[model samples]
Target: MNIVIVGAGLAGVSAAEELRNQGCPGQITLIGAEPHAPYERPPLSKGILLGDAEPDSTIVHDAQWYADHEVELITGVPVSEVDIDTGHVLLGDRHLPYDRLLLTTGSVPRRFPLADRSGADVVYLRTLDDALALKSRLTENLLIIGAGWIGLEVAAAARTAGGTVTVVEAADLPLAGVLGPELAPVFVDLHREHGVDLRLGTSVTAIEQRGGRTLVMLADGHQVSPDLILVGIGAEPDDHLAVKAGLDTDGGVLVDAWLRASDPHVYAAGDVANQEHPVLGRIRVEHWDTAIHQGRHAARNMLGQDDPYDRQPYFFTDQYDLGMEYVGHVGPEGYDEVVVRGELDDRVVTALWIRDNRVLAGMHLNDWDAIDPIRSWVGREADEELRNTASRLCPR
Candidate 1:
């Protein structure tokens, strides 16, 4: 048997490692579009940008590990096409046949459509190279175009580096789309306390370079000049290869509960896979933890294990003194009610999203000890009296 993995991100690398660990007697090939080895992306906006971590420290595995395991690791080369009928992947002039294929193509950052504007003063934090370039230019006035997780984290890093920071968001509150409007004020207050000039419910209509500085024209007839601008709107799944091969796709590559695509021989995981989650229905998550577990589950199914990827979604973020870990699943409508424990003013709070007295999701801000209990409460009906008890709810 021969296996070919299309991407070398966290999901692809995890699937490759799982296949080897399961003692698969096959030739495994890991192809990466990036020139460098696999690396973690969570720290790119925080630790890496703030000079707390070196680029080499974020690598998933060293060069010698791949050689020792006898896994063929190909970097800097992209697979142009995948021939489902021929059972081969086209790489420029060469083609490699595979008995089983896994696609963890991941996502690409959304870019702004500013014409005639050079990208020299604009940056996006998706790849390591982008992070390194932004890190070098973090010494002056910095303007961020989005108030999502990436933009907020980058704002925190810029402030920590002594750079004048300003954030512009189209939403009325920061993180309103994700965390909902009720909880968005927490983040708004967090940034304000750190001296970040946040302009909410507005957008940049025009961006122009003037005398080495970037002049940003806002929707409210105001102009501000900043040395650099970071755009972090979000990302879109890279599913072009899967779509060309005649596979079903919506926002991402559609996969069943077992992470198998329409074609049994081919499967997808991570950010590129729009999976039918057991609890959340059909959803696509671009989270680090989701990618790791989904990759391992995909590998098991590829090996004929038939295990469904049923884990709840999870993600974390760090900014200044605030550390947050969110678990569970909630749709765009959000929860019916929000239950709060601990003091929000003290920077220690645990908020739960409830629907019909059932805990749907939970978020812990500056409260690391609530992770276990919060996860345990998900999908379970909560007792109002028990949930209200601060002592029993979160035991230290």
Candidate 2:
């Protein structure tokens, strides 16, 4: 059997490796948009930006390794079209046929509104090239738009490199949308402790090149002139290809519990897939753990092996001398009471969002002991007293 994977991100590469491990003794071709080999993205915002890691350190596997495993990698060639009827993918003038096709085209960085092609001052951190570009521009003063994970990671790197960093967010709190209002203040404090000027409830009204620097105007009638600017709002799934091919598409490429797309021969995984969960029902998770897990699931199903992908969701980010881990959705209503497993005074805390004596969400800051029991609580299998002891939000 011949298999073709459309992306070279962690998901696609993981799928290819799993297929090999599963003993699929046919041709496997991995197509990537980037000219470089497959690499990890997590370090790009941390060690890489801080000048501690070399560009070559992120590669998941070298060229010779791929060749040894009989995996053909075609880098810098993006699949422009997927002809489902013909069972072929078109890349420029070349075409490749596949018995099974896996779509793992991760996501693209969301750009700032004021950014333009000519505005060399604006940068993003999605690809290796993007990280390298941002690394080169870390001169003196660096302004960041959005206080999300990527943005805060960049700010940490800039501050560690002896550059004055400033973060501007439109929300009242830095991580208002993700971590909610109560826990977001910790992030603000963390940034402040690192000497970062984090301006919340502030939006960039205008950005233009003035002399040798970039002039940033905020909605509050404040102006900032910086040598470099990094925008890290978020990422949108690359689902246009799946949609154009007549597959079901929602916020992401819709997939079943088996990680197969609406089509039988085609499947989607990773950040591009909005899969059906056994417990949570339907959701689109853009976490690294989910990506790797779903990719392996898709690979298994592709090889005629049926295994349900029912794993707990987990994601974490290291920024500003703190590690934040989140599990499960906190819901829209927000937490009524936050249970602290550890004291916030020690700069380490695990806040649990509890409602009706059940754990809805859990946020860990420099604390991993709370995660295991919380994970059991989230799965609804742990003892009540164990959860009660681990969580401090018991009812009166």
Clashes of 2: 0
1-396: candidate 2 lDDT, tens digit per residue: 999999999999999999998999999999999998888888899878888899999998999989988999999888899998999999999899999999999988876667655374677789888888888766578988888888998898888888898899998998777676667888788889989998888898888776766788899888888877788888999988898888899988898888888888999988898888776678777778887888888999999988767876788888867887788765565555666666565657776667656566676787756567567666343346755666563221
List the global CA lDDT of all models: 0.87, 0.82
> Per-prediction TM-score, please?
0.96, 0.93
- lDDT value, residue 372 of candidate 2: 74
Model 1 TM-score is 0.96
List residue ranges in candidate 2 displaced over 4 A.
117-120, 332-336, 381-384, 391-396
Best by lDDT: 1
Report the CA-based lDDT of candidate 1 relative to the real structure. Answer: 0.87
Evaluate candidate 2 by giving its C-alpha RMSD to the native, one decimal.
Answer: 2.6
